[model samples]
Target chain A: DAMVIQNPRYQVTQFGKPVTLSCSQTLNHNVMYWYQQKSSQAPKLLFHYYDKDFNNEADTPDNFQSRRPNTSFCFLDIRSPGLGDAAMYLCATSTRGQGGGETQYFGPGTRLLVL
Target chain B: DQQVKQNSPSLSVQEGRISILNCDYTNSMFDYFLWYKKYPAEGPTFLISISSIKDKNEDGRFTVFLNKSAKHLSLHIVPSQPGDSAVYFCAAMTGGSQGNLIFGKGTKLSVKP
Candidate 1:
């Protein structure tokens, strides 16, 4: 079935170390998004890619970056892991609909633990 | 400030009963609403959605009601089952091409058999 998939469901990294999380989609959606969710907090949008264009959230920290090499793959790279950055990283995909209210489909998510 | 809010942190319901999850929004530009369910260690899955043009939308045992004037929406599950227990999140979208969704903190629902 067409679905989103994430690799390394659980990741452990040392402080200040760089880590990357990967996402892929079989749904062939045009948009891909990355979100960080802390315990008991809302999932906050970090960045997204519409086709090849990258859009980053205003409040997203500089440590977080994303790359979309192709339609099916997107990656989130943390330049320097921090204790506060330890959270579940989610990847979502959606088709660019005419009404702008497209439903997003999410991957299983990668839980990052910064030591 | 939070654009979408789910005031209830958690809710408990008995099986075969009704479960109502409420959501409120502070943004008037939000024209579309959605409900997502998340199990532990997994990403949220889309449950149902309602457009601002409509007051309600239903599917199977789940129903979503939108009160645009009040900037509030609710999800109701009829004959709730133990399998339905999960975290429910309310999300809103502005009417544009960006499709960036603003989501509320989730409400964990526990349905006891």
Candidate 2:
């Protein structure tokens, strides 16, 4: 079953501690994305890798960073976790075919809690 | 600022009836749109989509209508089934290549059988 997979469905991190949330895809997609969703709000794009190129949203906090070491995997690193950073982190993948090919497929999402 | 807006926080529909969900966007640059369904503790699943080039798109019992002039779009489910009940999200795509999506706050729908 080719699908996006996220590890540690439920994650707990202490405040000011660095934590990493990871994502991988069996879909072998050309693009991978990271989105942050809070309670009852729209999921906001944190950043994405268009193949090997990483594009970050303007308002994304400096505490957050990502590394797509290769095509199959990507990691979201929170250098200094804050209480407000606790939320569901989602990973999505898509192909880069004709017409932008931005229609994304999502994973189960990682719910992070700050202690 | 949120480009796409779903004003209704939730909706209740009787089974075998019609369910209509609405979405509005402020960005005129958005030419592509999509609707996604989600259940609790799960990620959103793509449901239906409509492009600005077309007025509507339909698949099975799901129909999505686009009004480019009004910058509004709506999803219609006829003879709605309980299985169709879930959180519906509307997303707007701006630019073409390397374009990112702007999503609206979702509306949770419950279908009573």
Candidate 3:
């Protein structure tokens, strides 16, 4: 079954400390996305990669960064964790075809807790 | 600045009745819409979708209606079952190669048996 997978379903990090949440996919999709979702809010796009070409949202903070080392793996690195950043991090993937109406498949999501 | 909005936070319906979830969007460039169902501790699963070219799209017991003029779209479920209870999210897509999606906050639906 081809699906997206995220590591450390629950993560705890100290304030100002660096934390990395990882995502991988067996779907071999051309596009991979990272979204931040707070309680009672919609998931916000942080960044995404299209076959290694990184596209960051204009409103995304500088503290957030991402790297797609290969086709199947992508990593989200928080330069310094903040209490306000505590939320669920979701990873999703989609193919490039279908004329921009592609369906995105999501992982279970990594719930981050900044102490 | 929410591009997509699901005004209702929650809704309840009796089993075997109809369930309607509505969503509105401010972006006119959005030409595609999708509805996703999510359970607690699980990722959202795609349920149904509609395109700007089409007014409605149906699948199984689920149907999606898109009204381009009003910038409103809705998901309709017939003969709702308890198993259908979950969070329903409405998402819209702009016409581009990226296929980035703007999503609503989501509406929690409870189907009582």
As for candidate 1, its clashing pairs are none
Candidate closest to the true structure, highest TM-score = 1
Q: By summed lDDT, which 10 consecutive residues of candidate 2 chain A come out lowest?
A: A94-103
The sequence of per-residue lDDT tens digits that candidate 1 reaches over residues B1-113 is: 99999999999999999999999999999988999999999999999999899999999999999998899999999989999999999999887838789999999999999
Which regions in candidate 2 have their CA more than 4 angstroms from the true location?
none
In angstroms, the error of model 2 at A63 is 0.6
Candidate 3 chain B weakest ten by summed lDDT: B93-102
Report the interface RMSD that candidate 1 achieves against the true structure, in angstroms. Answer: 0.9
Q: What TM value does model 1 have?
A: 0.99
Instruction: Give the clashing residue pairs of candidate 2, or none.
Output: none
Those runs of model 1 whose alpha carbons end farther than 4 Å from true positions after fitting are none
- Give the TM-score, chain B only, in order for the candidates: 0.98, 0.96, 0.98
DockQ of 3: 0.76
Off by over 4 Å in 3: none
lDDT of 3 by residue, B1-113 (tens): 89999999999999999999999999999988899998987778889888899999999999999999999999999989999999999999986937778999999999999
Give the total clashing residue pairs for model 1. Answer: 0
A33 Cα displacement, candidate 2 (Å): 0.3
> How accurately is candidate 2 docked according to DockQ?
0.67
